[model samples]
Target: MFREANSTLVDREWRIAEVCQRLEHDLEVLGVTAIEDRLQDGVPETIYTLRKAGINFWMLTGDKQNTAIQIALSCNFISPEPKGQLLLIDGKTEEEVGRSLERVLLTMRTTASEPKDVAFVIDGWALEIALKHYWKAFTELAILSRTAICCRVTPSQKAQLVQILKSCDYRTLAIGDGGNDVRMIQQADIGVGISGREGLQAARAADYSIGRFRFLRRLILVHGRYSYNRTAFLSQYSFYKSLLICFIQIFFSFISGVSGTSLFNSVSLMAYNVFYTSIPVLVSVLDKDLSEETVMQHPQILFYCQAGRLLNPSTFAGWFGRSLFHAVVVFVISIHAYAFEKSEMEEVGMVALSGCIWLQAFVVTLETNSFTILQHLAIWGNLIAFYVINWIVCAIPSSGMYTIMFRLCGQPSYWLTILLMVAAGMGPILAIKYFRYTYRPSKINTLQQAERLGGPISVSREYRATTTTDRERSCSIINHSTEEQKPSLRTSSFRFS
Candidate 1:
């Protein structure tokens, strides 16, 4: 009865946090209960795969240091082997924490020249001191360590850590499943929440919510990668098709005495962009460079996505160059095909437009990796619609395009000119693609080939063997790129699964 009364008094004093906290600790332990929350299925394998994909992980928890370390090991966040050393940074005061941080930094530097499997473990008390007094040194240490565990940390500290990583220009993904995690979830670039025993607060606050943690593997490697690839292709191709027409116009201006006479009728230009070219590229959103099973098995391919290999300056330049070349081919071929004949300017415009449509179609065909039935219908149906629409428009005797399609379709040279444009535009692209696939095949390229042949992709083991190297190289690239910025050193971006 006396103990119950004391507990009630303590609860009532909760408004005074310091007094309430002191009373909470002073209470006697009448009994102890233990509950085991085992790791979910596939958690370890998923973590392993993500790590191989060049992602760093940091575990922030309110659990005791020993308990957190145990959980980290059980979940494969850190290795069990001797080589995977655990460095601890803990102290009660500012001076002690600073000295410990310097010592850890020294050790990290000594091993920086070689590959080492090391993870740092820090408790909340020392973390608070280190972050407040030695933020730069602590940030450097965090950058060097691939995995870290911060135990006994409060919700505010979790958010602060996320902010620190972001301030360094690193992308952060925070995952949590409790009310205490709300701040951290809201603070990150990408927040994922698990809908489980911890309740719905985190899920409500996060950008994405999942039933289990293991689903993260698919979320990032499969959907995330597909989204990036499709966006890049869509954006770049939009530019390519637009530029293809504009380049032809610029070249035509030089020959047309620079009087700004439009090569294509305004209606034709509108239809080309809105109806003729839009659907095919839109369908490209469904494209995949490799199969889901293949990507899941060989996560090392994620290096390409992490390193910005697909959507970089070099790729944009290639697309720009391709567009310029195709425009030149279409314009030069159409003009030369009717050089001797007394063709109408509208006829020349129709011929050139035809070549652009066909060339763009084949260009999309060349880029598509996985084509669905819907994609098939969109591409071919759009092509057919181009002619049927033009034919209908040309039927209107009052329209500028009157008899244009009919006049061009009757001539065999018109068809030959289109064929030449397609052949010339596609020829170089195909050759370069073939050479790259045959001689310098990337992991994704190899998977694409195997998928095409309906053969077994047994390269998982081979890829696993090189995952360490790929991860190191990815980190090296990020670190080297950010080496110059000291006060606000941009660090490697991290994605948490």
Candidate 2:
């Protein structure tokens, strides 16, 4: 057979090599050979922990189906026969592939009520056919399955799978250690490359490159959670502070007969975001809602990030309502305190602005989970700077705010108005926060309480997710802050080629 095939491929060297390789594969083995390769330490535990943290993993490889299944079983990626069912999808013709896919889908539905695990195994040929003609059905199958293994696939096929997941609105993370995985890594929402024996091609092309695959656990559970938390607070607080000032301006417009009249001068508007409110939120980037140890222990806390509990429409609405409420308090209190007396618009503006500054100071203090000396300085020093800058600006004879701060400083009424605004603006919010922290605390709140009291967090079993399905379902909605989901983290050392 080899001689005949070689004879037919006389001038085509590539075709001759392909024909010879196919002919040689069916021959009986003269001897058995095995290579001893071991996984890195702590890999299985890391995967288990991350699975509990709500990340679903799919194995895509160039190895044969049996080899991939063996590796998956050894690594605890899927359970064996009794506990888990591996549905195979394959065929040469389009019709055969469709029939196989439908059968698997039917089996999945049949076992939908069972506690047994389900995973679908597909080879390159069937995947190609399914993706071309039955992508929607394939997508549903992938989503329903606890895990999936795509074996005997090409580099492009891996990327195509990633694209399909993304098209279904699921965020994907592709991690690879070699050149063949470069396309897949780049195609994912986030690309993580493992710098190992395979090569540097994937690492160089990836968004982040890590030295070891096991470090992925920390990358996701600890650092990934922190990044999400910090980014959510920073982005939302930015909008909150800006909206606070804007809402005040909109209220001022009503009293000014809808005419365009600036409440605070141009300088104050410019300085509010840059100097006054910027530091605390910037410092908040270093804030941790829970300790690293606690986060690692309670990986289920990641559900908040995946579900966007921190910065979703609900949280945004809360911030929006707070800004509007504070704006109203500032405007009404300032206007009423100076109603009968002869007061300049500049003085009223100063009164409202001072209230804003003080209220912001306390808001940051209230929301802070862990406070360091730096945070104290950023919050308090910023308040001091506001006063000092205003005092200096009022001293200048030509400035619009001239004598405004000085007059307000001398009056007990100015101080009273500010006190009144702060109380009215933040009193309800602080009360609600206290009530929730004391009575209706979440797991995060409990963890935060433990951190504050410097005690060990004793998480209840109920706090931990019971099933893998529940955990993955919580990870369905990527946080809504960015147009794209926050970049996920994954790491792989498999040589796809």
Candidate 3:
């Protein structure tokens, strides 16, 4: 934020600022209107979406201070339209270097037709300027951070601001496309490199890469919040389903061993694990978010770890029902098989068991997430891989220990259904605790109108449409090149992702 202060310069700095201001004034008087238009189109749909989603944007630049302020206002990057904004910082000394180079090049111009000769003279002048007067230009920058929207900053100052923002625990993102910005980009939490034609170091350090700022809205505003809810939902269902499947497997194991009846054949066990157990878990975690207020949590899971004080009778009965059901089925089946003659096992039993497990898994998938069964791609893929491995392991002729653990082939009889009891007992308990997320109302209203300007959106070539009066227009200065200025401590303007 620049204030007209008592001169501390050798009297030349103020002269330079005044001359530059005069040049811009003359350009406007000559009808060379500065370009400023609304950067964010003011359609209600945009406003609604932005507000509903809750994300903020700030526009920082190395352009003239007034111009940056004007652009910020025009784009509504700072605030809602029509409210005046603050002018925090203005740094445009880099333009002076180009002017100096221009003069030097013109002096050497003699219709040199040969590009190499022209380039040689240009390089000489640039090198000479760099060798002298770099610091003289930088000391003029003022850091008015408390109320200022912008600051005339140098590379060191830019890096210092990064440190300051970091101290506040803000998840800072810096995006840029130039060499001068690499320092700030590296220091940020997420650095996105745009216009990589300039370089790749910045991009290499970034968490995500994208082509433009327009794509950033979905990531920051919408998907960010959405991912949070999705993850919580997935967590509940996957854990619930896992517990249920374990009980079913245990039940069939006892039926085989005790009742002299087969439970799951090797293939069936593999199918249950591959198709039924892991799919929901994989899908639930695919989209992850860590937003604080709009988290999806299940009520059963939320209070389970609390204590007996909150324990309800219904909760314990849930397990009782499942256990009783499994016990009764096992008792009837084993008694009948033991009392009567045993029969040869049919492939249908194995098929039915596998099918039942798959169905159970599918139903559980429906509990918490909006995703249809097919979208659980990672879960399904991993299941297939695990199934192949399980089959290979189980088909081994002498692996009695492995067969016992996972419920492999055995006699099909009801007396051996103790394993089934274990499975039925666990399923529902897991379901209530982990399979459903209690949805929460979003705290998106807490999001504020963004930007340091505090009022009009600032952007280049976009604020012109918003300015009606001369003062608003004057806040945006259009340079017509009077005094040549060079960026003393070349700092880059960056896009923070």
lDDT ranking, best first: 1, 2, 3
Model 1, span 1-497: residue lDDT tens: 33454557545444355555656886788999766545656768888888887777888777778877877787788899988878889899999999888988998888865667788888999999999899999888867777788888888988888887776655677877777778888888888876655568878998998876678889988998899899999999999999999999999999989999988888789899999999999999999998899889888777777666778889999899999999999999988887448788888888889899998899898899988999999898998999999999999989988888998889888887888888898999899999998999887887888888899886643343344333322221000000111223211111242
lDDT of 2 by residue, 132-155 (tens): 999889988866665788887788
lDDT of 1: 0.79
In model 1, how large is the Cα lDDT of residue 127? Answer: 95
Per-model TM-score, in order, reads 0.87, 0.88, 0.44
Candidate 2 minimal-lDDT segment of 10 residues: 476-485
lDDT of 3: 0.39
Question: Comparing candidate 1 with candidate 3, which one achieves the higher TM-score?
Answer: 1
Who wins the lDDT comparison?
Answer: 1
The candidate with the higher lDDT, 1 or 2, is 1
Model 1 per-residue lDDT at 211: 72
